[model samples]
Target: MYFSRLTFNPLVSHQQLAQTLLQDTYREHQALWQLFDTDPNAARDFLYRQVLEQGRIKYYVLSEREPVDRSGMWLVDVPKPYDPKLVEGQRLFFTLRANPVVTVATAEGKKLRHDVVMNAKKQMGFDALPPADRLPLQQIVQDSCVPWLQARAESNGFSLEPEWVTVDGYQQHESFAKQQKRPVRYSTVDFQGILTVTDPVRFRTALFSGIGKAKAFGCGLLLVKRV
Candidate 1:
């Protein structure tokens, strides 16, 4: 895998255009494929995350091969290979922007949905109680997202240090596909912490495959650094 960063230049266009590139699903998907020289149909191997750092629009991407610089709206750095040798018990610090959701059975049948935190609260019977008896949203999210992440790590070749994990920046995004014209809604949560590599092979797969849904729309990219 190769890693790259693209920073949008507001001087080339309005900030709205840059923001649209980050939010509009179809536009961003098409824009990402432009980084490669091959046909759009063949350029399907990549994961990207859009982030705002120090008031700048930046995107971090991981791809199977080096990317070609093809856009004037943004500046792309030379892509670097991310193929790392792995071993058991290696500790690292990581951050992930993921769409955390759960599958639930509804009247229509099984559906994958967001708000794992809300469901946790409901399981505690908070919805049936008075407002004052309910837990704060932050507390509920912290309680719920940790276990959810832990479950993901168990199969993904990592074990998160419970004491070091922190969850914040919870948000929901609504987008539409150009062809479908129907609204698509998803929620995102940011996770940061230290983790031990438990299964090298599975962990490598997790690194390349990403963590959750909406991977195309800037979610589920796990960015990590050796600690």
Candidate 2:
């Protein structure tokens, strides 16, 4: 696998145009698609995360193949081959932006994906509560998102303590696509903390293939480093 960082060229004259293009999620996806536009029929096999620092836009991408800079607008870092050596009982600090959802079956047995945070709010009847009785928003986010990650960790070959992780940045996004009538909708939550590898093999799969959904829209890329 290859890991790469992509950023707008500071020297580019169209800074404002670049910023505008990046603001639209669909446009951003199209721009990034140029890197892997080798096969017209190829399915997406990469995970990315968008980061904003000091008003500058940046993207981190992990893919099965090296990314090429087809557009002159980006300053593409040299793609580095990534193959982390892991061991059972290893601990590492990790950061992830994930689209967390739960599957619920309807009366007719149709399964639907619901945002975990929204689901929690619905289950708690948050909207019906008196203003003074409602829990802090951050508290609700933590309560809902932490367990969602923990449950994923258990099956993904890792373990996390609720107190060790910080969860925030819950946001809902809607982006229009010309090819589709309805807008693409999804929510993102950021998680940062330490995790221990209970099974290296499964952990490696999770790292390479990503965890959770919406991989195409800059979610589910698990970034990790030594503790």
For candidate 2, the lDDT comes to 0.88
Which is the leading candidate under TM-score?
A: 2
User: RMSD in angstroms, all models?
Assistant: 2.3, 1.8
- For each candidate in turn, the TM-score is 0.89, 0.93
lDDT of 2 by residue, 104-145 (tens): 999999999999988989999999999999999889889999
lDDT of 1: 0.82
Off by over 4 Å in 2: 13-23
lDDT of 1 at 223: 83
Report the lDDT tens digits of candidate 1 across residue range 1-227.
89999886556677647565656765776776787754755746889888899987688999987877656766888778898787999999999988878877788786757478767876899879899887888888788888889989979999999899999988877778655667887878899999999999999999999997888778888888899
